[model samples]
Target: MVNVGAKMDERMEINILDYRLKVMSIAKPAIERFTHALIDVLFFKSYLSGGCANNQHGFVSVTETDADYSVIVEEEAYKAFEGKSQDVKVNEQTWLPLVASTGPAMVVQNAAGISKIANSVVIPLADRGISVYPLSTYKTDYVLIQEADFDKVCEVLAQNFRITREGHLQSSEIVVEPTRVQKALPSGAGNSRALTHTFDCSDTNTYCMTSMDSKSLEPHGLAIIKALLYSGHQSEVQTSYFFNLSIIEQDISLILNVTLLNKFPAHLFFDNSEYWRLITIGDMPEGVGFRQAGIVAQISEPIASADISEYYISSFYYGHAFVPFDQFDEVRRLLIKKQNSQKAAAAAKLSNGL
Candidate 1:
């Protein structure tokens, strides 16, 4: 829905996992033993439907330290292993369980440098809410993501990256809009010391305010204020400042028109230069006497400017507003085209030994 244009790339779906899985950490000194357990469960026990196809084989992350080697496997696989061998001690925990996309994901073998993929491919996808897990190889770096999310992944990579079931490179043009809400703030807020101003809207009584100066307002704050003023689509929001101050009872009732402070949970509007974000979790039902906007929360990541390649993306702020959900097909089309373009560029660089 973001007007990405007509040139859409081809999307291919692959087999992936269905249900969520619990993590089973197997501490075994011999890696071969763990491999044998999985082989036995798959070949002899036949707990899985078939070999990797249809995602019968789930995600397994193994970490090898000097003291111990741990093999974290899927829940179903662990159960099958337990059925086969009762003596093995398996620790089951919910620490960051691997969740793969539904159906077979088209795996792309990108013969590109890790740093290049990190900056060019991974960072862009992450910004668009598409997660790509890069599996490293001797010459080619394999990029894995759920087939369902591949279109969006490809769209984010469009123009600068490429993807092929067979390792071939392609190219395209890409347009990047880095900010969320582009609309300028009201002229009244132009003054630095301004506190609050009420805008005339056709529907609701909207009051816009800044706890601090206009310069202190980050992209996150501006986006929230804009969304509150206008009817737009906002999915997720992230910020670095937290609010704990309490508001007086009468002011809370007058402002939000709710009796229970917990129901209306008022947070102090500070003018301090800090990062703040309001995330629209879900649609609010009719007649629930509260602000239509979603939860307002903040984080601790400092407000700073740094390039994605120069440093870690910890302090970066990227927000999306007015994303067109109705025009999904068009969005996907633009995404795929951009992905091919990126791939072509990367391939060209690799061929020239860049």
Candidate 2:
């Protein structure tokens, strides 16, 4: 077993990806209309073009749950969805992606390590009232911040983290201001109501999280791409409701319904045995732009407190958390406890105000 604590203490590196991304969601019923558009982003040469000056690296992520489909793509790629349907909801904010890693590689086998990495970055940002949308891959975790918050995010996290910019011909280090001091939240702060009422656990399907080398695409890309096309068509039949394909520069991580694993060869992935349950955080009210602070911390803190292994993916409209199958009930229990605690704290504060 790897020493997770020791690993956590290692010097952290965060790469700021140079892409202006937009988050979009499609209602399950409207997914059919976006099938070709989705296919194009995933497979076509035109959509694969990088978002930077070198045109070598770009990012695209698509996630579906029982509630809706969430997509993260370059601002240019978002044109495909324009005027497509009233069912599609798009956030107008432009987001920047920051990829976080500690060592040569992040080992996904250690549950504690994953939670520790998430909490280190998320909790600090949350404390200072900065909103963050976090996504986890097999290799590392991504923190997506609104472009407006980038400067403050740098100010808050610069003390402990080594920040840099990537996706250009030469990488540049982000200079941290030494005189800036971090702020702490007062007792009983933040959006407690949003934390308490915005989440629900999906009891319908169990999922498997797996990954393949980006190089694998060289030989099996066509077959896997065909499977995705078929899966989109199968959406009408409703055999599965959750699938996530996250293609970073060197890694491709997939979260798929266990029932649908047969679509791809077992040998193509690293390990196909782990099972996870879904907890979906409903979309913020329209125009909210995913900027409310402490949402990720509120959901992740309780689970991590229990030492449970969890993964989070924040889409434009929703936030998704996956816990081990056996631990699902326990996670739900922890969340309810946290919700009640927030409610009680809110009530006590109101009484004091009275």
Candidate 3:
């Protein structure tokens, strides 16, 4: 067990602990097939019909929206389209179809969502003078690159993001998957409506957030964990509360409150030290204080295991170190500073009427 002592000297920016992680990519054959490309972002009054789904077979990728649909299709797919028949008729309204030239496309499947891998892949391409037109899907991130530039794009992504042909993290480690339950809030935190929802991790399981095993987590479970880790404190009422409350309920409780509270909402009294530990320390305090130390240990003690650490780092937008080991206390303090600085900036922005 590590004791994170009170106030450490302020430090400068900390880089993400280089995990030497390997990512997966698929771009070669995609580049070989298509030099000319057409990307279509469709707008409809409602969800596209089954016909649209069937018609998009050879597309680079297709994403559906409540009001519209978007797709990146190979030239062959567009070429096969009988232009007039492509129009989707919805409620007696017709949406005309138009195709425009775009770059060759490839997809990156990451369990951690966009923020986790965006900087890893995107910035490097920007530095290498590669322009990327990205489209996001529920399960993957797609980018359109020119066939001419595919080689450079592939090289950059492969080198920096460790993209492999598999297009996903291929690892054999077993991990306990997290299960999510959406339930109505006992009391609305902010703008959430009376009958509106909050997400709770129903499982009392814990897993390593930073180790190679992280790659083996179920995609959705990894996504939810990443959501908790990568979450930043927003200034808005709804979004901010959602982030805070989620961390308290999911990452802190689901991962920590194993024996204490086996249920969704605990019955601990406010006066109890355990209760204060959850709200004040375990929740990631806004300011630095000695009283807030040992938070990582408190949450991690019950589930401590050799395969997984009591500590894990969040390699999200500006990484936050959550390790409970003394060796990483410096990194943890840096995270605290970063969070405080962000909150301070938000407060200043609000006060300045921005």
Candidate 4:
């Protein structure tokens, strides 16, 4: 059994960001109406004014899946979607982002590191009934929770680990007393026992995960933005299975389909040579909303157990895991085997009527 508290202490350093964020989804067909506004947030409006030390204010992420586009933006940047709520499905509740890093000296070059971090932070929170939306970039992991749950979350986690807020306004560490006993992580703690969902790989597309320092964008930001704007007009690009652009603070990350990636110059990104394949987890049933927990842990744990590296993104509607193109076959086989074993065990239990 894994010691959840010890694992977290060794692997993660977390901060509760000050930004109030919003998660919204728009159908692919309707995204055109707000293209310009989205561009401005990505390029100009998202950046914070002054040297406020927390100039990391402009946070915007747009994730495209087969069904729709999920947009996560800072509350201020959300003004672009105002008055057009009818066209977009916006979650009325505000959310706060918790940034988890592996420290400055450590670099997460594989999915195993990501998996460990997810297991440590996400699993414990899920076990306690906290529903978190997780987003991963090349350099960092973000777990977003409803603003209303902030204090409760801090209290729960502070018992096992120290909690601190990021940004200039609230840089102080959260003061809390340890009230609960730390325990080993339960085996299969994050399994999707209550919901029926299947995992499948994308048949038509492969993806590339890459990123650039936000400052690097200064040289070719407009050209790159224009390329993205024009690429959206292409029917092929519109229908692609997965594409993501996330800008948080000084980090800019992208998960683009090979076809869409061709639109940008090679010099714009690092690690552009590597390719990834997507494993799309079936969407949660209607009415589940984001209340469902451990979805990430279920998928990530299996892959991580196999020592396979994976990048995960959970949008408003669906969850996606991207594995290295060369290792996709192995990862798929492992998941299928795990699935079969679970099914067999389940059938035997049903037969015994236990």
Highest-TM-score candidate = 4
Angstrom error of the Cα, residue 72, model 4: value is 0.7
**True-structure lDDT of candidate 1:** 0.28
The lDDT of model 3 is 0.25
The digit string of per-residue lDDT tens for model 3 on 1-354 reads: 211111111211111111111111112223212222211211110122343333322223322211122233333334333232323211111111111111112112321222333334434444454443333222233443444554454444432222222212442211111221112122212121111111112222222211112222233333333332222222321211111111100111122222222322233211122210111121211221111112222222222211122222111111111232322334334335545665787799999996
TM-score of every model versus the real structure: 0.27, 0.81, 0.24, 0.84
As a TM-score, model 2 comes out at 0.81
The superposed Cα distance between candidate 4 and the true structure at residue 53, in angstroms, equals 13
Candidate 2 structure lDDT: 0.70
RMSD of 2: 5.6
Query: On residues 167-220, what C-alpha lDDT tens digit does candidate 2 reach at each position?
Result: 557777777556663543443354432473367774567788889876576587
Q: How far is candidate 4 from the true structure (C-alpha RMSD, Å)?
A: 4.4
**Candidate 4 at residue 70, lDDT?**
85
Tens digit of lDDT per residue, candidate 1, span 140-246? Answer: 32344544554455455443322323211332233334232122223222222111111111111111212322232232333323322221222322111111110
Q: Where is model 2 more than 4 Å wrong at Cα?
A: 1-10, 47-56, 83-87, 103-114, 181-194, 215-240, 283-289, 346-354
Number of clashes in every candidate structure?
23, 0, 4, 2
TM-score of model number 4: 0.84
Alpha-carbon deviation at 57 in model 2, angstroms: 2.4
Which candidate would rank higher by TM-score, 3 or 4? 4
Which parts of model 1 are misplaced by more than 4 Å?
A: 1-24, 28-36, 41-45, 50-63, 67-75, 81-113, 125-133, 138-354
Give the alpha carbon lDDT tens digit for every residue of 39-73 in model 4.
Answer: 77777774456422454556778887666778998
